[model samples]
Target: MKHKRSLLALPYVGWMALFVVAPIVMVVVYAFTTAGFEPTASNFTGMGTYVSIFARSFQLALIATVICLLIGYPISYVMAKEGPGFQRVATVLIMLPMWVNFLLRTYSWMAILENNGLLNQLFDAIGLFDLINGLFGTDLTYFRMIRTQGAVVLGMVYNYLPFMILPIYSVILKLDRSLLEAAQDLGANSAYVFRRVIFPLSLPGVLSGVTMVFVPSVSTFAISRLLGGGTHMMLGDLIEQQFLGGAYNPHLGSAIALVMMLIVIVCMWVMNRFGQGEEQAVVL
Candidate 1:
């Protein structure tokens, strides 16, 4: 039976090696070697010049992740409490935008936020721009919303918010009703019940959502490109320039990729440690 089980897993193991392990190995090899196939530390040494890019990416991703958490946690809580039909509809609504292509969704934001786009036109039609100028005694015609860091963060939040919601919702739905009831029976109020019971048990899901949202937000290039209009460069943009853009330095791109992979691993470890600590506290 053990041999049969191992046989059954061979296909999955082979798939991982071919599609996942092999690619990672190739990237590591490229990261450490030069175009002449000689090992060198220059690729990583070059990263020192682009420290600001990594900082900006992490900052924007952090902001977006926080925004998603603030907006999504309440939505997830409400969804968890709703009837099955309502929950289904709410979930579908949350995920509806994901059906469209990611690039298309980002492009749509560009159309909305550009200087001469629908947003400005609507502001003009409603005299909002004039009102703002009148109130402030300035001659501002538009807000210059696109091609900026804020726009990139907005795109990141819009795209990744659903990821934050879904995991928390799943965890909330599986919460032990008896535990909540026991808290209530012990004279715990609504706020107290949630603070003591509900929130504690949902740490795993919160961590999961944070990982899902932060990882993608930190690594995204398309949203930053379309919404930021190449004005701001994130880590993804830097990596892309090295590999696909005029720079055409695959070794440097791989080095950046490896660095990011390490950062992500460290983040996961920290979150795991934090969650375990919280779990122990809750148990006590």
Candidate 2:
């Protein structure tokens, strides 16, 4: 019976081989081969130009990840402590933005943040910009809010925030209230209880949320492209331009893809280490 049940997984294994394994093999081959199918190091030899792009990408993603954590953790905590009706309404509201297509959401931001768009118009109507300009005695009318690095980071946080919230919320909801009560009975204050009890148990969820938000934030091209106005180039943009842009260099594109994969793998390893620490804390 065990042997028969094991055989049931053969189709899934075969699917992975065909879809996952084969594509990775092709990418590896392309990364190392020239257009004529000959081995060449030219693809990697040209990585000097991409160093700044990689650094900028990492910086932007890190900013977005940290912002998500700071914003999401508190919201998740509140949601977890709420009644069923409140949680239901809050969950729907939190996830409502995701019902729209991601590209559409991004485009909507473009409209909101554009120089002549709703935000600037609202500022003009409210006389806030005029007040600032008058106070400073400058002729400034509209600040350049869109097409900047900050805009890109804002887009990332907005889009990926729910990924952070959901995991932490799930973990917080499962927390043993009895432990919290016990700590309080022992004269522990709210801050002390959170510091000693609640936070340690929530590490797993924090790690999971970091993984979910960071991985996608690091590789995202669309947000950077649309929000940064193509001035900010990340690893994803480099890979995209290599393959689909004017260059048409599959070898270089594959190399960039491999590098992105390695970065994500490193992030996962770091998250795993944190998870192990969480387990140790639980044991203690």
Candidate 3:
């Protein structure tokens, strides 16, 4: 009775069961099936599809995840250091964009990154635009960062920043300040205190942030679509393409999706390990 009660404890678990787990099972079954409703393969013919995913889509996701983590860490730290009032204000400011539609925000980025955009106007005002025009001559648009890897990264950071910041900030806010004080009183310098005390204390936040940003950013398709000129297809975009009939190979697509999921799960495990490692470093 106790075990049964524990199993059914989560109401939201039903949603997870229906949506997340069910879809995953569907993909798994579909991955080994060929088109035209054939029952030839049985979860064993997706090796080629899985291989392509590793070679292309996985690389794209890894780059995007790295970009998010690199840019989000410092911003999260600053927000965490602020007082409660300020933290709330910053949170509101940071989260304000999330209240708006994601597609709208992506469109906004396109507006600024397109040719004859606001950024080019600012650059021209500063004479840098003309300087680039003189330097590159026929490649002003490319120089200005439109439809490139940089643009894709920019879009990812914009959408996922709040995800990274919120988790890290929550952990940092609850961190004990006494540890830093103790380190300082023991004649440790500022750098030492930060390296030995503050950073270790904030590891939980850091790990949470890394996991939060890394997983979704890796699998995200929209940023690459709008900013990457369709050439920088991430795993999300590839999976999405299959579902939306662009690829027309849903079987192959499911294999790609499952492989991407495995990568994310491994990353999540690694992130949790880092958090535990950080905890071990703390004196208490």
Best TM-score among the predictions, by candidate number = 1
**Model 1 weakest lDDT span, ten residues long:** 275-284
lDDT, residue 53, model 3: 45
Residue range 1-284, candidate 3, lDDT tens digits: 99888788776788889998998888887876678657656434545644664555556555656666666667777777877888788889988999999989998998888767777777767888577778878555334577787788788778887877787778777777887788889999988987777777777777777677767777888888898878766677777888895667788778777767887798788768767975785655
| Number of colliding residue pairs in model 2 | 0
Tell me the lDDT of model 1 at 173. Answer: 98
Looking at model 3, residue 251 earns an lDDT score of 83
* Candidate 1 C-alpha error for residue 194, in Å: 0.4
Ranking the candidates on lDDT from highest down gives 1, 2, 3
Clashes of each: 0, 0, 0
- Highest lDDT among the candidates is held by which one? 1
Tally clashes: model 3: 0
**TM-score, prediction 2:** 0.95
Q: What are the runs in model 3 whose C-alpha is more than 4 Å off?
A: 1-13, 36-57, 132-144, 278-284
TM-score of candidate 3 versus the correct structure, residues matched by position: 0.83
Sort the candidates on TM-score, descending order.
1, 2, 3
- Can you give the lDDT of residue 168 in candidate 3? 71
